[model samples]
Target chain A: MTGITLAVPSKGRLEELTREWFAANGLVITRPGGARSYLGAIEGLPEVTVRFFPASEIARELIRGNVDFGVTGRDLIHETSETGPQSVAIARPLGFGNADVVVAVPDAWIDVTRMHDLADVASDFRSRHGRWLRIATKYITITRQHFARFGIAEYRIVESLGATEAAPASGVADIIVDITTTGSTLTANALRVLEDGVLLQSEACLIVSRTAKFSARRRAQLDSVLSRLGAEVSL
Target chain B: MTNAAFRRTNLEALVEAQGATRATPPLLLPADPYFDLAGEEFGRRLLLTTATTGAEYCLRPDFTLPIVTDYIANGVGQPAAFSYLGPIFRQREDGPAEFDQAGIELLAQPDGDVALDQVFTFARAALDMFGVSPNIRLGGVGLFEALLAQADMPAPWRSRIRHRFGHPEALERLLKRLAVSHDTKPQKQPSRADLVTDITEQMVAAGLSLAEGRTPEEIADRYLEKQALNDAHVPAETLALLHEYLAISGPVLQSLTRIEALAASRRLMLGAPIRAIRRHLNGLGEARVTFDASFSPRLDYYTGIVFEMTGRTGDVLASGGQYDRLLERLGAQAPIAASGCSVWIDRLEAEFRQ
Candidate 1:
């Protein structure tokens, strides 16, 4: 029988929310060995197999069609690549995780308030220093596309694997594009997000892979799960 | 990493072997030039430099423009075939910077159709090697442009229609309106001639010459206290009629007939490129091509066909088009008619891994 594979975050508060959400839908999720064991299942939705993975891996797997559907963050999906027709966002505001991907500069630069200011600074930096302005961020694609819309031609991007907020003071970058739910981390780093610099306000979402094979049995199983979940949640 | 390395080496060898058969050396290009040619948004990531004389350059965003530049600079007037392989950059919302892209360019070909076919063949083969069986969907911008010409709309209105033809929402809206009969009077149906006359008179009174970059439409809008006039704000009744005509723009063969009928009705003639493109599309058998009258690429550089190949999962794995005007902007004396595609290697790799 064809079954729909559903991936969920394996651990952390996200995992707890996954179980709670499933339980609220009258489907119980359980992993016997807790931390070490990655396997989990939703009670009464036996046809739907739940594979536990990190949030990022879940997003990737959904895109690859390795899993029929998955729950992950909108930021993760956008961070992974351009969202195309192959992936459909089934449900958003899943109410567990939320964050904003933003562009931030040094707090000392009070005059810089919007993306246009950043564009101006980028151009001035390039002309005066004879080099492109450097921006550190993990969200390189979104950053590039955003800056392009403003007609800012000359700017460099340094990929930051971690601690992006520290890049400006650390001399690793001139500015940063990163995620922040609160301004505390940015303030601690002496960096402040610019006004109108929030590129994306992301939250958790239910996503389905358009490329995934959906047999009659699997589709029915998905419909059943969605119906149960829909009944449980109030619009 | 090892698997990727192996794939890269294997592809490089195969391309090199093909290059030798054509008596051309495989052109190895640095990633930076591709990024430079791609300009602002298209370029991937730029690495900052410390050397005083060194400029920050990015990983190449695309291959065609750089390859074309190489062809023009090194082998000007000579036939050259060049292939390249390297990691390109694009931001992944959740991932890293580098993505592999490899392709070839054939310059100075007598027949562009033959070259286009080869490019398609190469794309199919490349995807096949990675076990991706893609369904090819085709469309042409020229055919859409031809249909707009027949709409008998003013230039600004025609431009607006042409600009938005490829957009599904805009096209569908236009088509739906065009298909219906308009019995109601428009909220506003100012005469274009009168508007033009009023604008000219206003400009003359203001001591502004007509030649001062002021279009008749602009002057008309100023007198009417309206924003810039395009076909978009035309009376709903008139637009409905125009829409009815546009709704019939279909597949290449059917679209040709529709365009012909439209031209006869309007007493207008189709341009040469439109004719050439129709002939080309007619020859492409069962390519799943649609003639979208309103397909505009986000990148303004695209002068002709713009397409994006999406995976079954809905990810845009590859997107490219003809950019005949880009070369001129980059300082070429004559317009270079060229087309190229870039595969989102990271997305491809992700699909393969899955």
Candidate 2:
């Protein structure tokens, strides 16, 4: 009736990699309806049950302690405050997903190279324009914390649902903070990343919840699965 | 009356002559600043308020802000002292809801350091009256900043190091990377063999046995321990060289001599603040202190000196630091330097009574 509930990404290359990783460790994943089903089973590990969810939702679920373990990106984990005793990172560098969150402004502003320059410009803009400097990003918490450290008080955050890099060019915001793997899109939009504004360089990670309930037998089963997985990775 | 009454009479007379007194004020305070501005995380559940002007107020979470407001409202710019003792509310499942805190704030003082030293003496005397023997530990945030300057590290790495310095594990990792030359050719990714070898060497060095098989997590923990051991084990010859270059620790009067000598040896110019720190330490005998080249505290507000006092049980009884920039965020124009310690009253009472 009870088992360790594990959530993994539902679709895309990350989902494929998650299944392959477990299969490589001799734990085959099978679903009753195959491709159409969200539920799955880990072969030879009956004590483990698998649920399918997006990587972001998986992170949230793990933080809420609704799942014993999950696979998600490190960026999602850091963005949310519900971590630590509520949940913790078990392993990282799952070797599939990788990206960096960066702060970029208009490329024409060649004078800005660091966060300190942004701070200076923010103060000057408030003095001249009589309005707080605006930054557009989905990562409002990270952006707010980073600026708070530099004592930059006069700034407003504009939440972006998608395509944050286009905000600066489209007059939605004065600056943008978004995830980027390459400079191509930013350069195309005439936006350049500041040298010191990379907030996080994140990769995929396996997380475990500290508050998850486990019987002695279930814990032993989980340990066996983890040990086998660890060995397969090393090989 | 006997000798006890005579001593009590003399003490009361002295207290009256000095105009030293105390009072208790209402525990409840306006919730606006205490909850909203102070960022009280769980106030809604813990604080109860009477609806006085159709507005709710909570018990005061801290004394500094309320005292400052009182000072400004009364136009009391001249040097004045006040003490408060009462319960402050915050949500805690493990402790009492209403706890007592006693403190005195001295406002409008020209010499912040003099006021800081006076507070330390007052705290010591107060604890002595309760028959507590507490150990005093001294450190300064300036020391870590100076070390960063001495290392010539880049700004990004310096910020990262400073941010994580309070966590012992993270600090150890940073120090290991700093100890190695960054320009050296990157080593090949570590293999299981490398990890095993490191672990075996550490086990031998630490007198631990390798007879029992370890799980992956256990092995990983041992590996981390070995890495820390490798970092902390600086050679005597390297230490001598470092001492000659940094000249950081010595007798109080000779501290400057050592610093200057080390700076000259390293071809580095000691900054003005470094000299000021040496001057400050010279007055407080250096023999009573030890300068740890790697010590750093967690609090981000500390812009200068930071210290902690401990009791015989090795638990830190009091800790505080100078936060010259904290008042600026609270809307003060001129920088106000301050340092004060919060005595663990419950722990002190328990220990002294025992």
Candidate 3:
């Protein structure tokens, strides 16, 4: 049988956390080709193959069914797929790497403290400025869906590569939907999260791709691995 | 299956007879105006593409936006009438993305009554060309606003409620949240006394002298105002009246009478809007028109008097509404009184096929 493939974040704190979580669960990952190698194998599981990728790429691979499982942020999984839980299912949340996707505006906008209030302000901004209210965000799909839910239709999205918190001050965008853990960065930029504007509370999760084909033997292997990791996932 | 020959002869001739100049709007238009005017829900249905220059364009989903923009650009001062016949493009759930549409736009009409009469006359005339006077459904945001304005609440609450009136589910949830008494959620926030002490400490640490800045009394008053805003709730009577108002749906004339009685009972002053709507319905004569208060259309630009004509098979053949602020939002210097109706030629063809 072809070995089962699992994807994990290749870099940064996420990678370190992934290794530590797996080790704590009794599965140690080893890189035979060196730490720089993208391929690895789980100790004592000859059938389980591990591949390192960026968190975003891990999400994509899982969605495309190129990988059987992945450990990535819930936000990235949502961003990668239009229909949540149709292509992949969350096995379990890892509980760390917690961040909230939120809507924020300059604190000086004292009149705007709620999503509904933002709607009114957006319309007013359009008429006065003769353009759609610009919202800078790296999470375009999430922002669009969340704004649509609130019936906010009068804003344009400006894709942010980095430093999204500086968008409002630099006149790049009027507001932002960004990821924040401590909120110190947002507050440093003089922005405040709207009272009812937390769109998603995301954490790293172990996800199983529903589109992946699993043989009887592969399914048994996955079940054992999940049990040892205390994931309690249903394939 | 429709009489294409009749559409070419009768509908065009009827539109011309109404003194509307036939014109053609460009097939592709800047996509931002549509998203800005209609909202993202409608915008997502559009067929959009970006050019190398990074300018986004979409196939014209409907003629109204382009026609009004053209009027504002070329014919703002004079009352103008125009007619368009062509294929509009959009992603449809039930049919081809491209389909034929024909409609008339009346812009800068001086009198609202005359504008309504003219638009309704064209709607009737177009249907008469098919020799079928279908049932018409009417709704208006003005009536909803009039009823909402009578509720005694803070301006922000009133405004937020009005903004959400078009969306029934959101309005319902919002009303329920506002109705819950503040005393029930004792643990949800810090006590007011604790908050005052905390704020005083923070102000002192930040080097703001209490006397130089806001005094303790002013701060306390502001805190109370903030609490009032936070705890704002619609009175039970007002909530019931609003639900009753939204539920007033039946024959246009009967619904008007029902609204009249309801307003009288509630002591809400909706007299002017009720009278205006009653006058328009009466003006429609014996046409089979029904009214539904919660009938805002997909297009958010409709400020008043939205309507649709349904065929015998329950297929919508035409729909339109009045939009006084459309031009101003589209970049005009001031609001222009506008109203028009659109005939769904493709739907008419399907109706005939059936």
Candidate 4:
């Protein structure tokens, strides 16, 4: 019988977390080639095969239908794929790698408490400063959609590389939209989140790409593997 | 492709007959320099950019900039008309963004009225060449700005709303905001309720700190400013009047009447732009076109009369408008009166095939 390919991150905290979660779910993964092996098998469920790849690629592979199921963060899926029903389905949220994609501004703008207030501030800032208010973030799509929804048009997006939270302090941008977990980076830079600026609460999820057609054996293997993980509850 | 070629020839002839010399600009240009001035809206839509000399250079975003820059660089101080047929690039949210455009540019075009009339005539003929009955709309954002100039609103509010004329939803929001009067009058006793959560409480929380940008008193003032919006409400009559003005959409002449009446009642000065548009339409003398009173062009550089022609399916077949301020901003010796129109070659081709 052809095996159902299960993809997970090859290294990092995500790899450790995935192993522990699988072990807790009563599935022991074994590989003859040991730690460095990219291919492995799940014990007690022989038809369930595991493939180790970079954490970011897991989502892309799942969406490509190359694998039956995979683990990746919600942010990556939102960033990389056109997600929808019948394409790639989020079978369950694995619940680790929590981060909030947020819009933030200087704490000094104590007057800008809400999205509408920020819009007003943007206009005021423009006339005063002689340029559109700039927001630095790698999440261009999310930032554009969210900003447009609030009718904030007098702003520009500067595609930032790293340390987006420090953009405002470094004089590159007037504001920022970034993914933050602890809120420590933003605070250290004296930035504050608007009252309603949270764009997304993202975490890892198990996704099944609908692009792949499964035979009866592969389908059964997937069902058995999911049930063992107790993630079947989501289905 | 044949139809596009024919339409291009037809448009070029019409523009040439009006004393334009055919000119072609080079495809590539410095992109990073334009980024700061084009603002975010147009800057984002620029399609091609490549790194050069520690900055990104770009393809030509619009015809006006390149044509004008060419003239200025050539030291052509005299009146001139130039026509061009070429591909322009814009980044679209969907589909291919590169498009072939045929249009003209008039330098030192004598006066505002003549320049507008010239462009209007060109738009009419171009639409005719495509064999589509022109569905025309004329939006006077200049008139709108003049109206705002008479309003008691703050400069920040006025400037924001004035620039948003092309964006209907945002313009509506601005109108709603205008209908309410912000409560900016100082109070004898500022309430402590706006600051019940102690500042120190935030400091103890990890990854949280007060910004040195504003003092506690200044923060309190901000809270007061927002609270002012709570009680700020404009008179019902004024709001209804503004709504009625925004709602007026139909034939150009009728819309003008409604606008004149609104101006008379409210004492808003729309005299200059209204007179100019009336003169231009009367000059055209019943061309096969219908006017939309509510339409504004998307290009923010359009400082005055914005016109667009649509097909039966509501597709924009051709559009152009005035950008006198654009010339001034681009370093013209004085604010120059300029207007131009562009015909979409593909849409014209589609019309011919059908």
Q: List DockQ, one per candidate, in order.
A: 0.08, 0.02, 0.17, 0.27
Q: What lDDT is reached at residue A33 by model 1? A: 70
Report the lDDT tens digits of candidate 3 across residue range A1-235: 5779999888889989989999988889887887689999999898999999999998888877889998999999888655545678898999899999999976545456788767766745654565667889998878878887886666788889899998876677878999999999988787889999999999999998887888888888777788788776665
Error of 3 at B232 (Å): 8.4
- Give the Å error, residue A139, model 3: 2.2
Model 1: how far residue B69 lies from native, Å: 8.5
Whole-model lDDT, model 4: 0.71
Candidate 1 chain B weakest ten by summed lDDT: B20-29
Best by DockQ: 4
Q: Write the per-residue lDDT of candidate 4 for residues B70-113, one digit (tens) a residue.
A: 77667655777888778888776553377778887777777867
Tens digit of per-residue lDDT, candidate 2, span B1-354: 324344334333422332223434456777655433322122323465769576767676656567655655566446655555445665453433655445555555677666566556555554554455655554546655665555543333455455544444545444554566444443444665655666566434433334422222345443344344434444344334433433344333355456556656756655564554554454443224444333335445456665555666666555554555445434556656655544555555555546
Tally clashes: model 4.
Answer: 3
Clashes of 3: 0
The sequence of per-residue lDDT tens digits that candidate 1 reaches over residues B130-237 is 556654444556555555565544454564355344445544554454445554543464776876776566445433345423345643443243223312345564
User: What are the per-model C-alpha RMSD values against the true structure?
Assistant: 13.3, 16.0, 6.6, 5.4
Candidate maximizing TM-score = 4
Q: How does residue A189 of candidate 2 score in lDDT?
A: 75
Give a tens-digit lDDT track for model 3, residues B244-334.
8888888988998898899888887877877767777766777899999988864456786788888877878888878887887788888
For model 3 the local lDDT of residue B195 reads 58
Q: Write the per-residue lDDT of candidate 1 for residues A1-235, one digit (tens) a residue.
A: 4778888898888888877877876778777678888777777667777889999898788777788777888878776666532364554357767889998876544345666555445544533554556788988767876665544555677889899987766667777899998878988776778887888888777777666777877777776777777722111
lDDT of candidate 1 at residue A68, scale 0 to 100: 77
